[model samples]
Target chain A: MSFLAVEELVARIPDGAFVALPPDYSGCAMAAVRGLLWRPARGLRLLGVPQLGLQADLLIGAGCVAEIETAALSLGEHGLAPAFGRAWEEGAIAVRESTCPAIHAGLQAAEKGVPFMPLRGVLGSDLLGLRPDWKVIDNPFAEKDPILLVPAIRPDVALFHAPLADRAGNVWIGVRRELLTMAHAARRCLVTVEAVTEEDLLADDRTAAGTIPALYVEAVAEAPGGGWPVGLQGAYPADDAWLARYAREARTEAGFTAMLAEFVAR
Target chain B: MTREEVLLLIAEVARLLEGCRHVAVGALSPIPAAGALLARELADGAMRVSILGSRRHSPFTDGGRELFDCAAQGRIDAFFLSGVQIDGAGNVNLLGLRREGRPIRRFAGNFGAPYLAFLVPRLILFRTDHDPRSLVERVDFVTAPGSGPPGVWRRGGPVALLTPCCRFAFRDGRFLLESLHPGHDLEEIRARTGFAFALAGEPAVTPPPPEDWRARILGPVREALAEVYPAFAAGLGG
Candidate 1:
């Protein structure tokens, strides 16, 4: 398929879709998230691969996300993610807390088409009580060893920004290979990339190592400077001052509205 | 936290990681990251230090799961963790605080503390604030328990907890007084602490940043730290 516009790419995500997003340091599809604000998605169940940042906060603040399952919601060194924090505190949205490894293991289970994945630790945490889907089964192999088992988390959509994609639709994610797992586990993968290249990304062995083939990608959008505010690894750096401003202004309801108005093109 | 206190914390953390081969510092932990950097410097660059959020510092190419994988495989020797509340039993609550069973404040949730705490030996718990509210009799929520039931599989857990006021060795599933930082006393520690701890004897005074690594920390270590923690590194420059 040829490249679509970012808004067109986000249109593919159905309302109330279970979408998995990458962390801040990873390639977060900020442009597509912005497009989402314009094309409002309601009752969306958002999953942070392990954690989230400004992208999740904006969605939560805008009332686009109804449920969120994440290990962490941070602005990293920038400061507090006020919207996400307030949502958790107020119980305005359904908050499903998890540890990082559990989320990864759950998705990996889905990627492998398994029922569940066993992970070490989390045997005594309160997090177990919160997640009914997780079970503590005694290892059949070992006499008395107990391990935690997480149900597979197959997302409806996996969305992210990437540095490059070719005409054939293979996306280059570099070292953030968790995107591979996300794409594999999701029913459909939507990618908004910084640029589309003429050269084949898979033909070169060096690029082939980092490329996700066209088979997994459902659609690709050419969203220039797509990973804005938060950044793509080699594409750009995080806009710290802008993130700080977001954290500050998103503290109060009016402040959050003001931010929406500021960013959302009227 | 003053410049001196931060430097002191770095020195202490480095001391705690003397024999460690690979140490990992999570994001938002500047002191521990600096300590790991200092430890690597002291070891003549022989040790492997992975500070998350820095492309230059982190060696993980397979992605976020690699760190947990490393800990599981015994590749990581030491790691740093902090909590909103840490109790006498060393149970950490990185989960938010509550008021009358209602959530009031939330922290950046326990990122990898639950898994890493159990896998990595020599888990050094660090918190700048040494106060009663934070050092409680019991944490409201246990993100990771200090020790578990007899049948529970745990390779390692809290070995020590370093704070601005004092250092406590986590032994027998509870904190034991090791030393008091300068300008702090036994009474202050007792008053500020919410739980009971064993005062085996008179606690020794905590030492200043050692002479040998002090210069290296402020110079090359701080420079290295700037890649991930620019704002924090700038504070140590003066």
Candidate 2:
């Protein structure tokens, strides 16, 4: 079992690699993101599975991300993601604008080992016009009906934070099945956990159902409070005050830089 | 807009959601979330309201995936979507201004709008900013098309577009002026609107929210919204 430091694990991700991050509400590896920022990893192509929040914004602000493919980038109720907006406006990063279901469809295709997946929406929309890569075809089964098809999204590495992992390296991610899809679709999976248990998670039928076997996971690192400020489901609550402060202070480049220096650099 | 105007807008949205069985409010939609909660309360729990990011409101354990699945399965009766720009054709542009190679102004990427717009029976389009820039003649990008081609399998599309200026009912791939909000007239709406729309006879003034509805929104609804939207809820005046 290769248990590496968060820095080492992040370092293994080569520049320009397609790295996928989970949704805001899902288990986000904010600790790993902080580690990457500290290392100042560059030229990454970040993938947002339907949505993105703090992780994407920070990476973009830090100039670590070269490109981003996502459904949306917003801080939810915290309002607009300033860093992401600034980067986008400056044309600093390449963006592949996509819809939520389409992203999910692409990931599902990758999980199923398919080249592409057909979706039911985006027809006659400018999203179709923008994404020349996405093709429209007549449904063979149903004549005269057009449908949209999106290519599979297989990331080079799927990174996320989880509540716990057993000695066997199986991570228990109850109800957050999209994380499972992410792991299955990616070439490799790197996970940060709040705790590493000596108990076998798969031995118990209940835990086994929610557990992602060690076979999919490439590396496991102990990262307590890894998803700080963002919150890890069932493990912690989102630091609302910190998030609010980030929203207020991170409105400008200098403010954002200062925040990174204090929160990440230190 | 004033707090009272905002409350009225919420109430109008709640009115549109009158008979909806299940209404889902997406991320960053405090006003719609308030409206849905209000509708649910008025229905005496007969209506199910699910706001994304709220543990109490959202029944799904699997996050957005479950929400999308439920929406696709026709389980969601109504849903709310907003955009940086909305056109006369009922198209919404969540993606900001696009140049040849990249966007000049990128607000946010399109969330699950495309699929949900087609699947949900009642898709209520709302935007607080009501001006020529927002109500454009044509969107630079269509994140969720208000209408699709005849052969496209669409069970739902935009039912009503409520702006601070007026309410537009979408029919046959076009928005028709239904009613102008109070303190605004048809002439003002026309002057402000960038896109052209058919008039529904004489545009009536939007009815003000009931006293009870206003009380509910200013009271319990504000509390409910605080769970998901602390900043917006906290900003709401009593």
Q: In DockQ terms, which candidate is top?
A: 1
| Residue A103, model 2, lDDT | 83
True contacts kept of each: 0.72, 0.73
Listed models, DockQ each: 0.77, 0.62
User: Model 2 — TM-score against the truth?
Assistant: 0.92
lDDT of 1 by residue, A1-266 (tens): 55788878888988899999999989998888988887788888999989988888889888899998999888887776898878877788887889999889989899999999999998888878888978999998998999999999999999999999999999999999899989999999999998889999999999999999999999999888788788778878888777788888889989998987776762
Candidate 1, overall lDDT?
0.89
RMSD of each: 1.3, 2.4
What's the lDDT for all of these models? Answer: 0.89, 0.86
Give TM per candidate.
0.98, 0.92
Reference-based lDDT, residue B145, model 2: 84
**Clash pairs detected, candidate 1:** none
Q: Model 2 off-target regions past 4 Å?
A: A244-252, B99-102, B215-223, B234-238
Q: Which ten residues in a row have the lowest lDDT in candidate 2 chain B?
A: B98-107
